[model samples]
Target: MLLNNRIKAFVELGKFLKQFKSTGYEKVNTVLYNDDFFDEMILKINTAEHHNGWFTKENVVFAIEQWADALSEKNLKEWLSSYQLDTIPCKTIGIVMAGNIPLVGFHDFLCVLISGCKVLVKQSSNDDQLLPFLTSYLVSIAPELNESITFTKENFKDFDAIIATGSNNTARYFEYYFGNVPNIIRKNRNSVAILTGTETREELEALGEDIFRYYGLGCRNVSKLMVPQQYNFDSFFEAIYPFNIIINGNKYANNYDYNKAVYLMSNYKLLENGFLMLKEDKSYSSPIATLFYETYTSKETLLTTLEKDEEKIQCIVGNNITPTNIDFGTTQKPKLTDYADGIDIIQFLSKIK
Candidate 1:
């Protein structure tokens, strides 16, 4: 298939995804595929919770809507325009996906097929249903793409390159196993927010979304806060109180109960507001229903520390804190160009041959 055909198919997939949102799922005439696909998708969206307890309807729909907005012609063109697409040679690329958040590995899948290569995907068992269904819809829009896409449960073979996402331990295995292949091996990274004690109530509230969305499972979710010394938690706690209903889910509430008990037993001083817990810690990755915080003495000192630890960080959210920082609450809605780990995927794929 040609580049434009691939773009058209994804654009159509985006149109198909636009109908799903946190509010509800609605079928629209603009979707190019058959009614059967529309019906199947509706069923999948409804039953996503059964597949994975964390895959609630609201989170699944949020993921769908974000992708729907991203797959536009303008966005696709602008993201792909930086590379020389015609010079790329077709090859088979293997993808090992992560299921932390809905459609977490779709970008790699998109990059491989959009760059005129075949994709063999091995999905995380936690998130096996959604991507394959979407790929089927893409094939319906461009039947020629059928030969370029494959989903495998067996060992990965017959591929020229690979892109894999996993935790720090698994990444070491990936590095040793696929070390010889042209590959992008991703590991555990967490996002953080830097607060200078000058943020507005609105920005702090927006920061709540960054911390709570997807129940704080995604790499983009703000698991840690970098704050100035003497920062007050009164307003921070008030601003994020609106998200307290997150505790209604059994898995999240259970985690909160367990972690809170452990803290109390260890006599660790902590703060809580019924639903979420705030602990003073130095770690970037926090548990469910918990947010870790660290205090900094000076901006220069903090920046120097962060610069040295860039590999462990996925995104930094704040206002004017860093030149590369994402605005508060927008981390979950990453642009097509917001490559994870700051790696240019198209640039990676273009050189695969």
Candidate 2:
């Protein structure tokens, strides 16, 4: 299929996705193939938690909503505008998806197809439902794509290159196994926030969205904080109080209770609201229901530390703290060009032999 035709198909898919959002689902008769795929989409979104406890209905719908906004014709064109799509060579790309959050690997899937290459996906068993069904919808919109997408459980073979996301250990395995081929192997990375003691209450509240969304499972979620010395926690706690309802989820509550109990038993000092715990630590990756924070005496020292550990960080959220820092609460709402791990998949694919 021509690149424009592929883009049009995804634009249609985005319109179809727009009907299912966090607020509610609204059927749009103009959307193609809704009669056949709409109800099933609802069913999948509703039951996603049964397959993976973390895939709650609200979180799934929110993810869908983000994708709906991202796949617009204007956004897609702008994202791809710099690339010379016609000059790119076509090859079968193997993608090993991580299922920590809903549709986490969809970007890689979209990139391969949009660049006019075939995709072979090995989906994490934890998140295997939604993407395949969506692929069916895309195929209906553009039958030519039927030959371009494939999902598999068996070992990948006959693919020209690989893109894999996993923990540090699995990344090593990927490097060893897919070493001979062109590949983009990703390891564990977490996002953090830098608080200068001058942020508005609104910005702090927005930071709560970054922390609580997806129950803090995504790489983009802020798992840690960098605050100035002796920064007060009272305003921060008050701003984030609205999100305390997250503890009502049994799995989340269980984690909170268990982690809190363990900390208390170990005689660890903690700062906590009723629902969330704050701990003093130097790590970027914090456990569930907890946010690790460290105090920095100077901005220059902190920036040097962040630059030294750049690969371990996915995003740095703050008000102009860094040239590329994301705004508070927008970590989960990544643009198409905000490539993961700061590696551009389009550029990588363009040079595949």
Candidate 3:
């Protein structure tokens, strides 16, 4: 039971996007630059600095496809059929975007859209193009939704609810502004890997993609590595040696050169890499240009510790021993079906009723 016009509108958006293939680096910035009036200072960031900042043609097209796939009538019906979203009094929902990674703000948009509410999105300064371009196309495809969407940087007010994603520091600010309001506050987090078994060369190479994609600036990227105490670094290095080309690339190579010199000069305990940082520590997240990895003698103890700290862990990216749906390496892109922090957002909203 859906309106024919709405369905056609969504499908047409998909049709428009299917024609695009994500471009590399500067081309992506050019397209995004053309999309909106972001402040020039933010737009002029070094390419090596904001690796995933560029949303190439393929990325944009995939984003549209992802939106279409998420919004299809059949999928909505199936999702709704699983639970009673009707119990909640849904209305306008505001979302504050996170620009640290590509489309990190999209899940909140999906939440508002799926819950049958008008969406008011405030684009992050670091990300001004994607949403505006996207919504514009959607409006063209289906004029009916023109009323359902709004984008702005206005001081947010007059919203029934909101979702905000920011760094651990900014989350306090978000809480001050929107804490009383019903919302999902997403703070910065990074995924981890639990190594229980040995990995093949193919698997290690795949791990390289997980580490380097978006230049390791994403929450989904494996920012930390866990290996057994006896697991020597030889086989691992051999597997990733082929990716020397990737490590030696412009941005990555610079990160390597800088970090390597800093570690040696400061006498910090860390391994050398032209790109990746192999530090021995028990943490999940890393700085934009850093990696934190540690080894453990006891697998069982590590799993228990991880379970105890599940709040800090977002997703696991690895081979063999990861939990179901945690993701293998090759599928770097997440489908719209994937929920953030594994929370059932619809249920989260309904609980307040």
Candidate closest to the true structure, highest TM-score: 2
Candidate 2 lDDT tens digits, 1-353: 89999999999999999999777899999999889999999999989999999999999999999999999999999999999999988899999999999999999999999999999999999999999999999999999999989899999989999999999999999999999999999999999999999999999999999999999999999999999999999999999999999999999999999999999999999999978999999888899999999999999998998999899999999999889898999999999999999999999999898
Better-scoring candidate (lDDT), 2 or 3: 2
Per-candidate clashes come to 0, 0, 5
On TM-score, who's better, 2 or 3? 2
The list of candidate 2 runs beyond 4 A from truth reads: none
**Residue 177 in candidate 3, Cα distance off native in Å:** 1.3
- Note the Cα lDDT for every prediction shown: 0.91, 0.96, 0.64
- Which candidate leads the pack in lDDT? 2
Backbone clash total, candidate 1: 0
Cα-based lDDT at residue 100, candidate 1: 88
| TM-score: model 1 vs. ground truth | 0.98
lDDT tens digits, residue span 1-353, model 1 = 78999999999898888887777778887578658698888889889999999999899999999999999999999999888988888899999999988999999999888989899999999999999999889888899999999999998989998899999999999899899999899999999999987889999999999999999999999999999988889999989889989999999999999999999999999988999988999889999998999999988999998998899999999988888998998999999989989998778888875
